[model samples]
Target chain A: MFLAFDVDSLKYDAAGLIPAVVQDVRTNAVVMVAYMNKEAVKRTLESGETWFWSRSRQQFWHKGETSGNVQKIKEIFYDCDRDTLLVRVEQKGAACHEGYFSCFHYRILPDGGVQVVGERKFDPAKVYGKNGI
Target chain B: MFLAFDVDSLKYDAAGLIPAVVQDVRTNAVVMVAYMNKEAVKRTLESGETWFWSRSRQQFWHKGETSGNVQKIKEIFYDCDRDTLLVRVEQKGAACHEGYFSCFHYRILPDGGVQVVGERKFDPAKVYGKNGI
Candidate 1:
């Protein structure tokens, strides 16, 4: 039975941040993880898109605001403790500026050398805005 | 001013997790995010590899562990807060199972329709462990 998933059940880390795992809704691949403060969480919920605070930039950033690449939230699920988030988004174009659908588009050889198994699809310096990645 | 950077100074997210931003390092693209508990951090630290906790899998998983692609950490830096991480890696293949170098490799069209600007480089169902993403 599908019951109401209680928000109280969600757990946040000591800094009021939660671990959010972004998966390729189509491919089911684990994207990256970022800490979302309560406001980031609220922004994500309110905008129906992914939003997080850039620890470095120290500001709120929408996933696609700078770049045309946007993650439209199709579904949002919380882990048992609510400390983690599983975001299902419909991505358009290359989700990465490295010219790949995912930034993970690489592999390590048995000898520890990096090998290229995919092709880059975009130029970050152009798409990521003047601010850059 | 050229001294070795201290790993101890690196800040990690709560849950003993660090906010790692996997960039193309080559293209300078931002990939997805995932929390790395202490062990995961250590694994990443000692190996010069990116290791993180799969909250869903509840275990340790290296980037491109199952996929032929892998991220060989070339450089890892910490944010001022000591809570975030900047991971520079040489991606060898598709960083995402969706067939992109990065998961954020998508951009929403002006009309709100998802568009495909990149090409798929691999078949994840075949690469990722039979367990899948």
Candidate 2:
């Protein structure tokens, strides 16, 4: 049961943004979650790459445009509600800005303890600079 | 590499909502993505169950409350950005209201086609009635 990508069918928030969850295609590991606006969606569709609307930067950014950890889009799906997106991609390098393979690096224990699960792939400071990229 | 769950360090959206991506603890399959307000987070933590703030209803809902498809939370982690949450849960039944094991049932192809990858677990109409639960 599959459907075509119909932008009109999606339900964007009042801010005209929708959530996009990225996953590693090979491992099926969820890498990161980000927001996408109309422009970002259009660009992602056109470029076959991940484009995100940064809430903090208040702008559209191409994934790996700075870090070279580009996410080549393999497939994309919207949930039944159409407010959320699941994007399968071929991830290059690490997904986390903190130099991890995925943004979900920490694990919460049953007793309220924390543990690091994912391995560090690179040094963010080296790639993004000391102030951060 | 891991950090503790500090609610104070999180940066909630302007609407006081944070996105939470739920995954199956046993399978590592992403089940659903929902939003959570401060109250939802508190209740989920206290109850050991998944609680979400439905955007359409504009209210908090305890997962599996009416449908009995409860999600027992196993772990919860916030992304480095502090804007997203990763919740691992032990799902009892179908996670999607549509009776699918996951809300992400449809898959998009590279050539703009769609495919249904997951199997239906139950009949939503039978469970929720004609108009749906």
Candidate 3:
């Protein structure tokens, strides 16, 4: 569906910020959602990797730029919120950079026990699937 | 359905980290995603707010403590990743904190024009719904 925004285009709240969603390109699984300013989004589109605006640090970040588990962009879409975006990508190794395929690998049960979701796609220790750059 | 992880619990690759998904509790809409190490998860649960471990900073952060638009914990879940987490929460005013509801507020049309999605739920400039606590 076509979205309607407050102003035309994504009008960041004087902070030059926006939201981004990470979706598994193949399975259509929503991996995670993070915020990004204009630069972060621009960097992601240019680098084909995931980058986000660190609200705390007040800067830009490229996911796995140091870890090497890069996310190659397949496609990107925006939700009804022109300020939010969905990024579909082909994750090379661990998107979490924690050695997990996705960021959502755990669950907090009603009883208080936290259950870990998903599996280990790679090893953050040795680092799996290095593209041999 | 209950998820089954490869290992017993969240087995982060020597990194002690996990994945987290942000979902809007009311509409069940996914906001955006970001990765967090163990400390981030721990802080969020304890604070009853969103705290993510910045892999770069390698420290725990409490959302809204600085921004003021805190996300009250409505519910949090984990995907099958065993290492990932899905956090469902009641966003106070604007979840994005960037002045929009969820972070998904844009769409890249087939023609290449980026269509802004969603609306400005609140004015980021004035900081609405401060609760005045």
Candidate 4:
């Protein structure tokens, strides 16, 4: 329902952040979900790629900046509540830092067991180095 | 690699909550993403279903308690960062309150146009009443 480009209508939490769900445009597969501050959103819109505010690092980073798995933004939409964003992108390489196509590589079982549902597209140790790029 | 059942290792934000990404077990399609408190996590693990702490309502509610669109938990996994959760479940009926199978029903275009890529599964007015149940 949020078909307009009115960013002001979005309701940011007290942290001044909103969640962005990134999905592969072609496959319709969810690649990853990340948090975005106002600045990050603005940058993403302007650049036509994904930009996210890292909670742990306390900084903003462009997707695929460190690695080559850049997400070329195809379209962006807000939920009816305007609390979250759905970003469809052409994901290159892998979305997971661990080298998986998606960050959601594992599936959990009823017995609390995990199975690797996604394939390892690349190796983190090779891409990010032993200490992580 | 995060196969252990050490819930303590999870890093909740300053708000004492972690993001839970819910996906369909069979289709592997992401249904929705929500937040969970420590109590919600414990209850979800114990009950073999989903329990979420609503940020808006500031309360806890069981999935499908009102609409019978309950999510049967099959497995749950935390991201390597320990800040996010991926919950694989057998979702019943619709996941979106608006009657879509998933919250991500719209696909965005590069030119900022919107397309309804997902089919409507139910009518919210009938399920939740005139003003929401």
Candidate 5:
């Protein structure tokens, strides 16, 4: 049921980071996409929770560490190139800092316009504080 | 029904590229992930086909250009950060050069092992010639 998987086998970018696409296992909705360093990957594998490398903060980010929107890992998959990762998880609360269930709430129309889809699940100000996330 | 969506609103990386996650509109299965520059994005929007910036070749890549596995865009969405894109498409043939419908056919087990999931749709040798893509 399992084949050998060496963390080193994964292809990371020049910054030693790989993008991880987080999806809701129940709904099959892509909630968010973020980058992860080797340490973050190891931590996520060992802890069964989502861990990412925040490019802006330049640090390790344990999902829902402060907002309680933790993502419990259900399954993990990698692409053929061994570069990108797909993480299926059971998400708690809103995945978007903007209060939507998923970060991809803005749909693009054919005419080069955007439309907001889905409903807001929580208030960002209350969740991530005054400045928000 | 639509809000203004200027291509300039997107936040590209320092390399002027943005990662795009391509999914099958019918199955909701993530098919592939690739980077696209502003020009590629504009081409995709205008042509209604998937186009990407190939980092290795340093050129524009039109999906299925040689293999005839073109993907017709059904819908496109952007994340809250505007740094990532979600593209829903009607894929014509195998998305993976390895002949899988999706590139993410390798699953990772809890014990840090990998497993091949899903069925291969075509023979890469025949599809992309002897060496394959």
Candidate 6:
């Protein structure tokens, strides 16, 4: 089995959640960041896809379940502290629900104003409806 | 002033902290990840260096203050949700407290084992004493 690492060894916060930094394997861009509990971590590992815990919705979230913007796991790493996780993935389609390739599309300009860095890959209105995720 | 973005607009967690993913501007490598509060964000913007809120110590931390591995800000971006920050920087030296170039030096193997991927730039014993951070 590929489940070699003990999930219990991870240091979870008081809420049993740990922040996962997701990176695009090809571009080395940080596509998104999310929280994951033990179950979500295991699911991601076994399923070979990204799964996260939705703090706001208080439920398990299988990434790209609705949008089809799945992230295939390339590698996973835990920091020296064992508190945080860094996940490298081959992202299929835009990682951002807003249709940008990355969630961090809004760059902060020198003068403190914000600017959009890249073109959107898809339209949020069409993908997640008008409200957007 | 470069502090144009209003800090209040960014969302903070219950502990008044937002996760910041630090990336290498030139290499596109994510060097480290840490937390920042409103004051820390303001300090980073004003000082052009990373300043973070230490959740464990419950105080402000100036990156590289003791290690001299400071990360100079090149660009900063916030996600659409405004709950996270992606800070691209010109890293001076090793970003990991353990002396690795990046905090994410461990790569998980297919069999679930982890292997250290990079060489240590400095000795943690020499830098942070025997115990290390």
Identify the runs in model 2 with alpha carbons over 4 angstroms from their true place: A1-4, B1-6
Better of 4 and 6 by lDDT: 6
Model 6 CA lDDT for position B49: 95
Candidate 5 deviant stretches above 4 angstroms: A1-5, B1-5
| Candidate achieving higher DockQ, 1 or 4 | 4
- The alpha-carbon deviation from the true structure for residue A26 of candidate 3, after best TM-score superposition, in angstroms, is 1.3
TM-score of 3: 0.50
lDDT for B15 in candidate 4 is 86
Model 4, residue B97: displacement in angstroms? 1.9
A91: Cα error in model 2, Å: 1.4
Model 6 interface RMSD over true interface Cα atoms:
1.6
True contacts kept of each: 0.00, 0.51, 0.35, 0.24, 0.75, 0.76
A1-133 per-residue lDDT for model 1 (tens digits): 1122333445676666676656568765444456688778767766778888776678887887777777887756553233556666787666655556665444433343344545666777778656666
Candidate 6 residue B91 Cα shift, in angstroms, is: 0.9
Ranking by DockQ: 6, 5, 2, 4, 3, 1
DockQ of all predictions against the true structure, Cα-based? 0.05, 0.46, 0.19, 0.33, 0.60, 0.73
**Order the candidates by lDDT, highest first — what do you get?**
6, 5, 2, 4, 1, 3
lDDT of each: 0.62, 0.84, 0.62, 0.79, 0.90, 0.90
DockQ: the better of candidates 1 and 5: 5
Name the regions of candidate 1 deviating beyond 4 angstroms: A1-9, B1-133
Error of model 3, residue B115, in angstroms: 7.2
Q: lDDT value for candidate 6?
A: 0.90
Worst 10 residues of 4 chain B by lDDT: B1-10
Q: Which tens-of-lDDT digit does each residue in B13-110 have in candidate 6?
A: 89999999999998888888899999999999999999999988899999999899999998999998999999999998899999999998877777
In model 4, state the lDDT of residue B33.
82
Per-residue CA lDDT of model 6 for A34-63, tens digit only, reads 999999999988888999999988999999
Looking at candidate 4 chain A, the ten consecutive residues that score lowest on lDDT are: A1-10
TM-scores, one per candidate: 0.51, 0.90, 0.50, 0.83, 0.95, 0.96
Candidate 5 Cα RMSD after full superposition onto the native fold (Å): 2.3
Clashes (candidate 6): 1
TM-score of chain B of 2: 0.92
Which window of ten consecutive residues has the lowest lDDT sum in model 3 chain B? B1-10
Best candidate, TM-score-wise? 6
Listing every candidate in turn, what is its Cα RMSD in Å to the true structure after a full C-alpha superposition?
Answer: 11.2, 3.2, 9.8, 3.6, 2.3, 1.3
- Candidate 4 lDDT, B1-133, residue by residue in tens: 2223455667788889998878797877777888999888878887888999988789997988888999998767666566788787899998888888887666555455667767888899989888773
